[model samples]
Target: MAKPKILVTRRWPAVVEKRLSKSYNATLNPTDVAMASNAIATAFAKYDAICPTISDKLPAELFPQSRSRVRILGNYGVGFSHIDLDAAKAAGIVVTNTPGVLSECTADLVITLMLMVARRTSEGERQVRAGRWTGWRPTHMMGAKVSGATFGVLGFGRIGRSAAKRAHHGFGMKVIYYDAFPIAPDLAAESAAQSRDSIEAVLHEADAVSLHMPGGAENFHLINAERLALMKPTGILVNTARGEIIDGQALADALRSRTIAGAGLDVYEDEPTIPAALLQTNAVLLPHLGSATRATREAMGMMVADNLDAFFAGENLPNRVA
Candidate 1:
């Protein structure tokens, strides 16, 4: 039998790429640039499977207007909101995403963001780097205290639960979470977390909040002006989840008006394009580094490889979403 042809939309880790190339007829994107709609459509007609990362946007239009030969999509990341599920289903394309592999690393990043914003480390670094730092004073760069504070977690899934554990056990924080579905009682007890009925209640009570919800039309702007108003004037916000989960303009306004203390954001509403207002604020912004660790990334790639292996070998796919 001929080797199944596959297209990797972006660059992946070296070891996984080598393994994938040896197993299948794999083509890697040399430039590591995000594939355009036409390029994705072209790949759909040419390849048996196309592997994509979160950076690649696979909307409904990218799917073939007619029938498609693409049998499956091996998504490198956990989030599938970037790909249009309905369109993939309509085109008879199976979609699988990598999950559980990056949980610890991503949870670590959430904590890192929480600390960076609450302690104003980014602002302090900027001052020192720009030669604006003078001798230490009694009233320099005073920021919020994270230890023993109320840590609100949105979405109590694997990543959220991991972050709750860190906040509760590591920082001595009280973890309160809001999820549309119920979390296991034992898991909540283990993390010392209390589940809230609504997002508003968590916002009203927390000294610091971290978001870990999915992104799509339903949650396009989950944190708008009214939601921001529910938070305390000194509350800190951290987001390592989907960018659309929070309203960037509202967050920027809240930071400028001191309605909220500070923000730590790893993703943005638009990739590589930040809101002008946020850039000028003291918000600690990162270039979508939530699951960028070498180990985690390789694991994610191997997860995709495993799914593809099952897909071509006529075995059950482990992480099929569509």
Candidate 2:
């Protein structure tokens, strides 16, 4: 049988790239740049499967009006909101994403952000880098205490539960979470997290809050001005899930007014284009490095490879979404 043709939309780790080439007739994006919508549409007509990252936008408009040659989209990340599942279903295209592989790494980044924002580590680092730091004093760089504080988690999924473990056991912090669906009692007990009935409750009670929710129309602006107002003035916010989950402009204003203590964000509402207010604030910002570690990235790629293998073999895909 002929090898199923596949196109990797962006550059993946070299080891995974080599593995993919060995498994299938794979074409790597040499420039490592995002493919335009038209290019993606054209590729759909040519390839059996297309591997895409979060950076690629695959809206319903990009899918062919009728069925096309692309049988599957092997997404590299856990989130599938970037691809329009409705359109993929309409076109009879199967969609799969790498989920379990990056959970721990993303949880690590969540904790890193929570600590950085709460302790104002970024500000202090900036001062030191600019040679503006004076001698250490009692009042110098005083920040929030993480120990014994309330750590709120929005969307108690795998990443959120891992963060709760860190906060509860590692830092002696109390963990509380709110999820759209009720969390299983065993899972909640495992994390030592108290489940809340609503997002407002979590916002009002937490000393620091982390977001681990899915992104889409329903969750857009989940943390807006009114919601941010629900938080205590000393509260800190961390977002490693998706950018549209929080209103960046509202967060910026809150930071400027000291309505909230600080914020840490790994993702943005607009990729590569951040609001000026957030850039100017003491907020800890990252360029979506939640799953950037070599191990996690490689694992994600291998997971995608597995899905493609199952798809080609006419077997059930392990991570099929559509």
Candidate 3:
């Protein structure tokens, strides 16, 4: 039997390449860069599968261009917001993601963001770097306290539960959550998190709000002007999830006006181009780097490779996205 062809959208872990080369003709993207929709449509034509990241855009038009032999798409990241799902479905393609493996890494980053914002890590670093720091004063760079506060988690999932474990158990925070559906009773009981009726309810009640919802039409601009207004003037909002879920400009304006205290954002609507207005604010700005640990990157690559291996071998995928 002829070996299948693989189109790797970006350079992945070396280990994944070695395994893929064994069973499939793995071809790396010509450049270490994001491919345009037309480029992706053309390049994807020669392969049976393509592994894409959040940066890559797989448009609906590309589906029909792919050869009939193309069977699966092995996504390197967890979310599929970048892909046109309806197009992939119509083309009879299977989409798989690396879900459970990166949960802890992302969750840890969420907590890290919350801590950095709450504890004034970024400001202190800036102060020191700018050589403006003298001796510590009693009221120097004071911020919010996490202990004994209510932590409102939005969208309970693997990452959300992981974050809940840290906030509730490690910091003695009371965890309240808002999800469309009830989580498994056993899991909810184990996490010790209570569910809220609505997102507004969570916002109004939580001392800090951490978002974990997926990015899509339903969730786009979830934390808008009105929703963010519900937050306590002293509360913080942290998002390690998708960027478009929250309106960046609105949040920036809110921060400037002190609507909510501050925000810690890892992702953004126009990535690599944060709003000019947000540049000089108290917001803790980080490039989209939630699951950027070396160990986590390796695990994500391996999981994608494993999915590709299973699909090509006619086995059930461990993490199918569509």
Candidate 4:
């Protein structure tokens, strides 16, 4: 039988790429650039399966009006908000994502961001690199303390739980969280996290707030100007979740006006196109490196490969989201 032709939207880890090449006729993106919508629409007719990452935006308009030859969308990341699931479902396309594997790494990044922003390490590094450091004074670049502070988590899922553990056990911080769904008492006890009634409650009390919720229309701009106002003036916010969860402009304004002390973000509302206003602020920004670790990224790719294998073999997909 002929091998199933597959198209990987972005360049994956070398080991996983080699593994994929052995199983199917795989076409990996050499440029590692995001594929255009038109090209993605074209892939529907050409490939048996199309593997996409968080960077790819597969909207309803991109799906073929007619039935597509593509059978499955093997998403490389846990988040599938970038894809139009309804369109995929209507077109009889299966959608699967990689989860669980990236939880620890991503949570680690959340801690990294929190610490960087709280300690003003980014600013200190820049000062030293610019040859402007005149040695440390007693009051030199004094920043907020992280240990024993209240750590608020917006979503208490796998990544959130991991972050909570780090904060409570490693840093001796207090853990509090708010989740739309209820978490088991035993799970909450792991970090001694107390569940708040709403997002406002968490924002009002925490010295550092971390976001780990899903994105999409319902959550678009969930943390707008009003919600941001609820936060303590000295509080710091960190977002490793979907960028659309917070309004970029509002956050920028908050930072500029000292409404909030600082922010550390790994994701943005628009990729590679951060707001100029935000750039002017002292907010610590990273280029979406939530799961950029070599081991974690390779694991994510392997999960996608496993999903694709199960899909073609007529077995139950391991992480089917749609």
Query: Each model's TM-score, in the order given?
Result: 0.99, 0.98, 0.95, 0.99
TM-score of 1: 0.99
The most accurate candidate by lDDT is 4
Comparing 1 with 3 on TM-score, the higher-scoring candidate is: 1
Better of 2 and 4 by lDDT: 4
Q: lDDT of each model, Cα atoms only?
A: 0.92, 0.93, 0.86, 0.95
The most accurate candidate by TM-score is 4
Residue 228 displacement in candidate 3 (angstroms): 0.6
Pairs of residues at least 3 apart in sequence or in different chains that clash in candidate 4: none
What tens-digit string does per-residue lDDT give for candidate 3 at 47-156? 78888898887778667743345678899989888888888888788999988888998999888999998998999998899999998899999999999899899999
lDDT string, candidate 1, 230-271, tens digits: 999988899988999999999999999999988899999898
- The TM-score of predicted model 2 comes to 0.98
Candidate 1: where is the Cα deviation over 4 Å?
Answer: none
At residue 243, what lDDT does model 4 achieve?
Answer: 94
What's the candidate order when arranged by decreasing lDDT? 4, 2, 1, 3
User: Number of clashing pairs, model 4?
Assistant: 0
